[model samples]
Target: MKGIQHQLDLAFGENAVTVSRKAIDAGEQNLVLTANTRGAALKVFDGGATETGASKLFGGNLTASVSASVSNTSKAGTDAIHNTLDTNTKLTDLTDVDGNKLGLTAGNVINISGTQNGNAFSASITVKDNSSVSDIMNAMRNLDAFKGATVALDASNGKFVVKGANGQDKDISNLNFNAQKSSTDTTAVASFNKMFGGFTETQKAQDASSDNSLSMQIGANQGQTLAVDINDMGTKALRIQDVDVSTAKGAQSAISVINNAIESVSAERSKLGAYQNRLEHTINNLGTSSENLTASESRIRDVDMAKEMMEFQKNNILSQAAQAMLAQANQQPQGVLQLLR
Candidate 1:
């Protein structure tokens, strides 16, 4: 009976050893699954083919918005000037409407005065004895202050119209014309003053504008995004959306627009590249942390094969010794029965 009991104890010990081995196997399997999951996450971050679809963890879309560069346009502040003299009328031959001998002379001067960006400036043109109406117009056009301004002859209505250039609205507003003559020639100075008497308040200038923006998502967390006004890159900002590039003027405008767009795109790209670099560093850090954690888990859950084998040997030897002792005890019981007989 003792021998049988020892055999039953040995059977139970063997069963426990088998259960422990199975538990270790399950732990190793779980570790493998964990490793695989971490690898998949890394792949998603890096962007690659996966079982479900291509990874887009860090992939971002770029949008460029642009507003056209506007040229300021303004009308003249004063009414048109009606020329009383014929186109060929010489400066010395000019007279007032009342047939009075207006002492118009070659030494008469016309001054254009204005403020450009708050800086005061003045330009003058001297009249020659042979100067005609056309010659006077030419001289006005050549003046430094009026060089960029548009001067047109309205022959049908006998009027002169002057318009401020695209970007000279401030200067146009402060524009004033004065006629200077000899102290004794009051009539000539008066007549010259009447020629440009209409100038008063300059027309208001219109500024350029744009409505372009780029909304971007930068991270997985909520509210992790950046919205930038990419106004300088779009068709409207570049002034090409409505421009007709078929004409020389339109083509020149288009060139300017393209250059602006290129600059905008380059700046945006630089910003995005910086974000990419940061994300790459984050990925490297995550990978390192995961590796270290996995190693720690392995140490805790993984079985030491050599040590376990040594334990198994020790248990087996003890079980065998118990069985032998039980056998010896049974034989002694038999000897006791002989003593009883």
Candidate 2:
């Protein structure tokens, strides 16, 4: 017979491809397809900032001092023209009619008389009728009393008036008037101008007083005062304006510096946020890759139980057939023995 049972055993071993059984015996490791990924958790500021190449951290706030002050003072101004007064000045030894010797009281209203040529001239004056002022006023108009002179009221004061025509001095030393002790010596003209100069000097001094106050002091601070001589009247500042650097520039600079600092911080905060986003994306990518790799590995290394079962059934059928063939071959040897019997 073409079939040889023992030869089958010699050629094909008892179990070939038994690796399938070993694989089936080894159970599947993929009960679950678990995937995981992780990257560095996002940090606010650290090595990542350097790696990202961000802007340099800029600091804020600056202040500068400015010290300043100014001063103005009253300097010597133009000298104004002035008038002066003389207190010890008067005509002495003059008189009125009473047969009294010639004399004048402190404010005696005596007639002012000027002697021109050999006759006396009287100055126009206003005084009490009985007073010397009346006597001086009337003599000015009467030719007999004031021979060649006219009188004017001294506009500066109303007490007594004196003037001369042709700007000539009156000769009062030989003054000639009837009211005088003798009329022969009363209206002297050339002597009057000499006496009047003394009185004019005093009037000049009083006018000067009105033009200026000699000295004044102005306040700089509380207790501080500036001494000034006011020849010409005007207003002036004792203390000039000044700047306080500590308060003026410092306060405003502080605000500007603070604002710059705030802006810097805000910019840094924004950079940190960007870094966080990158980290999150990294974590997500790693997680997806790890999941895919795990799934591929599971498929490649898992067991197939249905294919193993089919192979096992075929082996069983082949094994049963081989046993029957082996019995038939041993029976042929038995037939040879039966013939010998």
TM-score of each: 0.31, 0.23
Residue lDDT tens for model 1, 1-341: 23422332242221111111112343331111011101111111111211222111111111111111122111111112323545677766655422333345777876667665566666666778777667656765776656566665555544445665644544445666667684345343765565454455343332211222333445557665544443345664443354445666445534544555577678888977876776677678768888999998888656676678889999999999999999998999899999999
Error of 2 at 238 (Å): 47
Candidate 1 local distance difference test against the native: 0.48
Taken over the whole model, the C-alpha lDDT of each candidate is 0.48, 0.32
Q: What is the C-alpha RMSD of each candidate to the true structure, in Å?
A: 43.0, 65.1
lDDT of 1 at 50: 19
Candidate number achieving the greatest TM-score relative to the actual structure: 1
Give model 2's TM-score versus the native structure: 0.23
* Model number with the top lDDT: 1
Model 2 misplaced stretches (Cα beyond 4 Å): 1-251, 303-327, 338-341
lDDT of 2: 0.32
